[model samples]
Target: MVFSWRKRKPRNGDKKVHNMELEIPRHFICPIALDLMKDPVTLSSGITYDRESIEKWLEDGNFTCPVTNQVLRSFDQIPNHSLRKMIQDWCVENRSHGIERIPTPRIPVSSAEVSEILFSITDSRRRLDRCGCLDSVHKIKKWGLESERNRRCVVANGAAGVIAAAFDAFAGDSFEKNAHAHLLEEMLCVMYWMFPLAQEAQIYLGSQASLRCMVWFLKSKDISVKQNSITVLKELLCCDQQYGEHLAAIDGVNRILFKFIKNPISPSITKASLMVIFHTVSSSNEKTKAEFVEMGLVSLLLESIIESEKSYCERALGVIDKLLETKQGREFATDNALSMPVLVKKILRISELATEYSVSAIWKLSKYEERVLMEALQVGAFQKLLLLIQVGCSDETKEKATELLKLLNPYRPGLECIDSLDFKDIKRSF
Candidate 1:
């Protein structure tokens, strides 16, 4: 209800008593809100307001009461429990009106409570007792669910770093198939809750043991565990390109990443895996990029772009552009059955970023090989490039489109669709 304030006598700071237009009692309403107060708390100035409303007032750097305009001696607000009970009773009496009862407010989690919980997590991690780890982490999950503040509290207390230390210990023997995997999943779930992690958390996650930990988790048959692992790895790789490069260099790590994309667990997981792929290729040496291509990443990339949701599709385009940077990558794309059509299909149909990456991928393909220009034309790359230029795109992408048009426009179609020819095809031809 809107309050129309007329000048009032000296009371609290300009207390605007409710403009009695409604059928509600003035004392039943918060003075500041001019409406029924849920969870009323009396300030030092003898003014009561909805806790949320006053908290916001305080948060806005206002030290004075909205009603009294009197400066607060202290910011403490005492819960007006009597007023709350009266409000609840009134709401029940007026249930026929549209009034719904406000549920009892939860006391927000405190730093001390969070500290005790973190201590339990630390103790549980150190001991490696599955039952203890489960109990502690369950408490954390409960605390986190109570409010965003609790999540911040958990992160502030280095929950992620502690979990990473636990994960690191588990990685040393992840292949043993013990209770560590289940406990690791619990730890990972909690850590994943606080992504864009605190610095202390990132420090532990960026270590070598965490890399090995990630590799083992990717092999997890449990989809939830694997998805969480992929997502966390995606962020970690982004933080340090070296992490991506290092992961790519690890034994069978690239294979696991490639395999994740190949199998297609979920859209989010797929996009994350694509990012991990792009980061690894972009940050690594030429040999590392080539090794990924040789391991059959290019075909899966094409499949991803084709089958993907918007997120996966965009990431797949980025990986493709990164892949074409190396000779091995280019050769694989040129020979892959889906490369030409996938590049052509994405040019105008996807988002601008997708168009940019698609144009760049095609440019790398046709620019280097020149012979691939024939295949691009046959797959209608020439027409897509022409459309892209005429409409809109980034300046660099537009320029590449123009260049490809200049090259492919001169080429006639049906110049032998050799894009599908792999090493076996070439061997047969020879």
Candidate 2:
């Protein structure tokens, strides 16, 4: 890796240099490149780095100082003139040792430049220039990745709306099959990078058309698009609870959600999709619950309960608890093969919250349906309930278990109650 810059004989009055090797000063080396820094800049974390190396790091979507592993409070990188001078001096001294002096690096784009890009993209009168503006938007997205300040600038300049418009434009009339699908994905990626977006901006971009476009993104073959689409929708849903109903009403929401459940692309995607469903159902009426039942959510929950990890199981159980508020949900749970066993298996096994949810589901079923009661008895639910009472459980869990036991006690074998019309009057005579 070493290169000879020059070869010269020893000069007069110079001490004989025994070491022929050239070694870079430790302070001059960039943490990223492990070479002499060309343009040294100090971050808010009190770490100094090469401007080009740090800029590239930020562009790659990293938000922390690489050397110290500290989350940077400010994205600004101030030029370290002292360090730069020292490095330059070291380079000059080593010139005879074949060391090359580093050149200055380019400065990053300014917020004003990003602002101009966003304005052009949003200004429709310049129709011919929109494409070029979108290209600028892509550049701004790159800049945003470099630092939080740039990210805030992107949002402040209405990048959210611009990205939404890009989504709608490139989605085309046929939408999913649009030729500009890559542009659509790029827009989504930018939006995700600018996450925790302003509420007003989220509301602005949460238009009906935008909702539909995001739903379409869920069905995309591209996994990144799908992840970003769900993430954006989840964030938008957080902006306003009313949007949950609007999202649920959108076509293919249920189908796509079910698809995510049936064939998960990743744990994160599955969790987000489930959250959307949970949010939608939370704002909905009985009809929505029935629709969820018709979409086979019950079966999906049962499968998820058995196969998924603790967190997924907890979420599935929570959603099932909501769905079981309706007759259809109760029927689905009572009839499914894995429903009872999985419910019984998870009780007292995963987490306190999970145990509470499982007990609640079983309590709902056993209270109304005799068949479910018998099924519960056969599956050792009664024993588990008694055990739940004896062992430590939450107050709510103990109350539910006690109620379930009371309901089942009457149905216990040889414990049938007789008509007692005259018993009050007969008293001791009986």
Per residue, candidate 1 scores C-alpha lDDT tens digits across 245-307 of 778767888888777778777777878888888888888888878877887888877876676
Candidate 2 lDDT by residue in tens digits, 371-397: 776666656677677766776688988
Candidate 1 similarity to native, TM-score: 0.76
Give the runs in model 2 whose Cα sits over 4 Å from its true position.
Answer: 1-39, 42-77, 85-110, 124-130, 145-158, 161-182, 377-402, 409-430
Error of 2 at 124 (Å): 4.7
- What TM-score fits each model? 0.76, 0.67
TM-score of 2: 0.67
Q: Rate the local accuracy (lDDT) of all candidates.
A: 0.76, 0.75
Residue 320, model 2: Cα distance from true site in angstroms = 1.8
- Alpha carbon lDDT at 285, candidate 2: 76
Tell me how candidate 2 scores on lDDT: 0.75
Give RMSD to native, each candidate.
10.3, 12.1
